[model samples]
Target: MKSFDVAIIGSGPAGASAAFELSKSGISTVIIEKETLPRYKTCGGGFVFRGRKNMPFDIASVVEKEFHSIDTYFSKKHPHLTTTRDQPIITMVMRDAFDNLIVEKAKENGVTLLQNHKVENITFGDTQILHTTEGDIEAKFIIAADGALSPIAKIAGWKETRTIIPALEYEIEVPKADFERLSQNVRFDIDAIPYGYGWCFPKKNHLSVGVGVFTKTNKKINLKEHYATYLQTLGITEILSEAAHGFVIPVTPRTDIFVQKNVFLTGDAAGLADPLVAEGISNAILSGVQAAQAIIESNLDSEKAAALYTAKLEETILPEIRIGAKLSYHFYHQSTFRNIVLKKYGQFVAEAMTDLFMGERTYPADYKASVTRKIKEAIF
Candidate 1:
């Protein structure tokens, strides 16, 4: 058995960030991960500049593409609108590479990583103990940075509600000419299939074309077929490859009670992904930082420290996600109304949408306020 001041389950961004913060405070911290480092992870891999503003270390080395404009389409609706931004709005990278970069940083900061450790069970005595494949380890505090199906949060009996959204993605090697054209812009098609969106995100040598549908029943829409249709719509007929994968993602707003007793939860395990865009990398890292701060600020009362962390999230992040959920609902259902707004508002609408997408603004409260104000002014 090995003992540490803090133990983190899951070596994603949340866990790595928490470990980096804790280890820098001279606290003995250990990270347990079920999979080997640099595991294959499917994601949009789009990180906005706003999300990277406060990172603990430099991230330029891992960025695959930095996009300056966003083109949103409404294919399911009658009218379509495209929005563009003159400035860079999103930084795209591979999830495996980005996560590995952070974990390596945590290691460099003196955090011990227990690779290939699957947590069997976690129990809390005077101190917290984690039973894993390797052995048992004790810690004064534990953070569950695991993911949506966090074993640590479940072991602590922390209640959480997760709403699943089916997402299918692909890493396609497009023709050189197609790649050259896509490199200048990032394209998105709303309701491209149904109840979801399709995207063409450009990288160094390839384009990520994918779709996410909000269907409860697994009717099983052929993602590859849908991708082909989308490419045809874009006037693309080149078939380079058909490599693809599908996964489920939770979309509801996450809670602040992620921290409980001797345990705390972060990232997907804590259900922190934004319901609107399903973007979570930045949120994961932010939550990890807050978790570490809570531990370092913990004196005689750990509850107070946890409460502080929850407060910061509620005050800063939760409100935005809540609004994102509402806006996402409208975007999925009210395509006509969205098209009207986009065509009418054009750039203003585009910039605002970009702001919300980039985490620079929250659509939940501000969006409602805008609607109410418009109604009062009889604009609608």
Candidate 2:
């Protein structure tokens, strides 16, 4: 059996990022992926500048589009908001290429990759054994970064304790006129669906359009019905060619421990997608790095690594998500009040949101206080 200091399941952004960090530190790490490199990954494909700038290596080769400004339409609930910044607010990239690039970088740092290797089961002990269709490997620690439906996490004895919401995305090729007209800007239409939002992201040769229900709901939502409406809203009458895929995003972190025995969970496996926007790419990469760093800083001590990883998340990501979850609840449900706040302090709030996107600010603990102050001003 093959052995390493750490074994990572799934070669998505989180796993790839963790592999890159660990191998760079001269730690023995291996990435086991069930699919081949550059496989199709369903996502909004909007890589925000916050995540892009933090990447250690250049990824300009895969970037399809870069926007310095963004438009958000509230559909008459409030005034439309446009925000701009010096840095690109959102960078677009196809996930297959984007994820492959990161894995390649990790490989250069001597991380081993086993592609098309499906993990069948795991035998837990002080050193875990990962049984896969391809082969068996032993590692002192296991990092589960396999995305929303994480098999590794399940095998490690995790239950569904996170809030997961569904989304549908289409890679659409439209008529030249329609594509040209809509491809110039990135726009998000709020309330394009009930309790959800729709986005039109322009890619190099097509539009990546999707709608996601960002709030928690038990009622059924027909996403296709809403998607069709969104197409009409964007004036995309006909699609020359399109590929639609549906997936779920985990917006809240798991309430349980991130580490179990010798296993650690990162990215979607740990339910670390951003609560407000439901974007996982940025936090996926960040959490992966932190997990790897914890292992490294602990000098391969599993107990210390677990504690360090938890501390790392509590320091920022978890707290931010907690507040973001609360804010998202109100932002979607309290439309009347949200509109009131927006009407009075539209530009200020818009700028603040843009800053949050740019990583210039985190989810503000003082957001409530700021909104209270603005409401008083409006009332007076």
Candidate 3:
């Protein structure tokens, strides 16, 4: 068996981030990916500024477009609201290029990457043994960044407690006229779907349009039909072949545990997507870096590493997600609540969100107390 200090499953943002951080620390690490390098990934491809600011290196080479403002609407005909920032609030990139860039950076930092190698089974003993289609390997520690339906997490018995939500995306090649009109700004229509939202993100030559839903809700809605309606609303009549893809987004962290012995679950595997925006890239990178940090801090001690990771999650990511979950529950569940907030304080709320995404402010830390107070005042 080929042995290494750390082995990461998946080569997405979370896995690549962990590999980069581990390689920088001189740890022997390898990434095993199920797909070939630069393979297509289904996502809106909107990289929020907060995530960009947290990246260790510049991503200008991969950024397709940067937007300074966002246009939000309750519906197609509703009076839209705009939020602006002096700096770009969001940078868009195709996931194939963006993910590959991160992985290449990790390789530059001396991390080994095994592409098109699917891990079939994993055994836990003194060290974790990963049996892959290519071969077998042993690792002192495992970081599962394999995403929403992480097989590694399931084998390690960590996935059952997580909350997974359904999401669908389309890479639409609209007419130049439609593209120009739609690409004027990043758009989000909240009332396009119940318990979720629809977004139009402009890339270099195309638009990434999609709708997602929080499956935990009891509402039965056809997401595909809704996506079609969304495109029609944007006046996009043609969609390229193989442009539609469906995936799941993890909305809440695993409540039971984030770490099990030598295995650490990061990113969507750990259910780290933001509840409010359904954004996962930022939290994925953060958790990946934190996981690497925990291992480094513990000197490869499994128990200590797991404990440290859990503590770091509590200190940083979990609190915000918890508050976000509460906020989403209230905002999506009650139309009356939404109306009250939008009618009375929509502009302030939109500006606060823009500031949060721009890294100038943080949720729960900067607005939780005030938001709670305002909501109470509005309701009462």
TM-score against native, each model: 0.90, 0.98, 0.95
Evaluated against the true structure, the overall lDDT of model 2 is: 0.91
Q: For model 1, what is the error of residue 297's alpha carbon versus the real structure, in angstroms, after optimal superposition?
A: 1.5
Clashing residue pairs in candidate 2 (N, C-alpha, C atoms within 3 angstroms): none
lDDT of 3 by residue, 1-380 (tens): 78899999999999999999999889999999999999998888888998998899999999999999899988533478999888889999888999999999999989999988899998898988999999999998999999989999889876487667887888878777888999989999886878888999998998888999863686777999999888877788866543888998888888898888588999999999988888889999999999999999999888889999999999988998988877777677776767776767888888988987887776765455676677787888
Pairs of residues clashing in candidate 1: 147-268, 147-269, 148-268, 323-364
Deviation (Å) of 250 in candidate 1? 1.8
Per-residue accuracy of model 1 over 27-129 as CA lDDT, tens digit each: 8899988889899787888887667767868888889988877777665433544545554688889878888898898889898999999999877877888
Candidate 2 vs. truth: CA RMSD? 1.1
Worst 10 residues of 3 by lDDT: 363-372
The 0-to-1 C-alpha lDDT of every candidate, in the order given, reads 0.77, 0.91, 0.87
Candidate 3, overall lDDT?
0.87
Compared with the true structure, model 3 gives a TM-score of 0.95
Per-residue error for 298 in candidate 1, Å, reads 1.8
> Which scores higher on TM-score, 1 or 3?
3
- Top model by lDDT, which number? 2
Top of the candidates by TM-score? 2
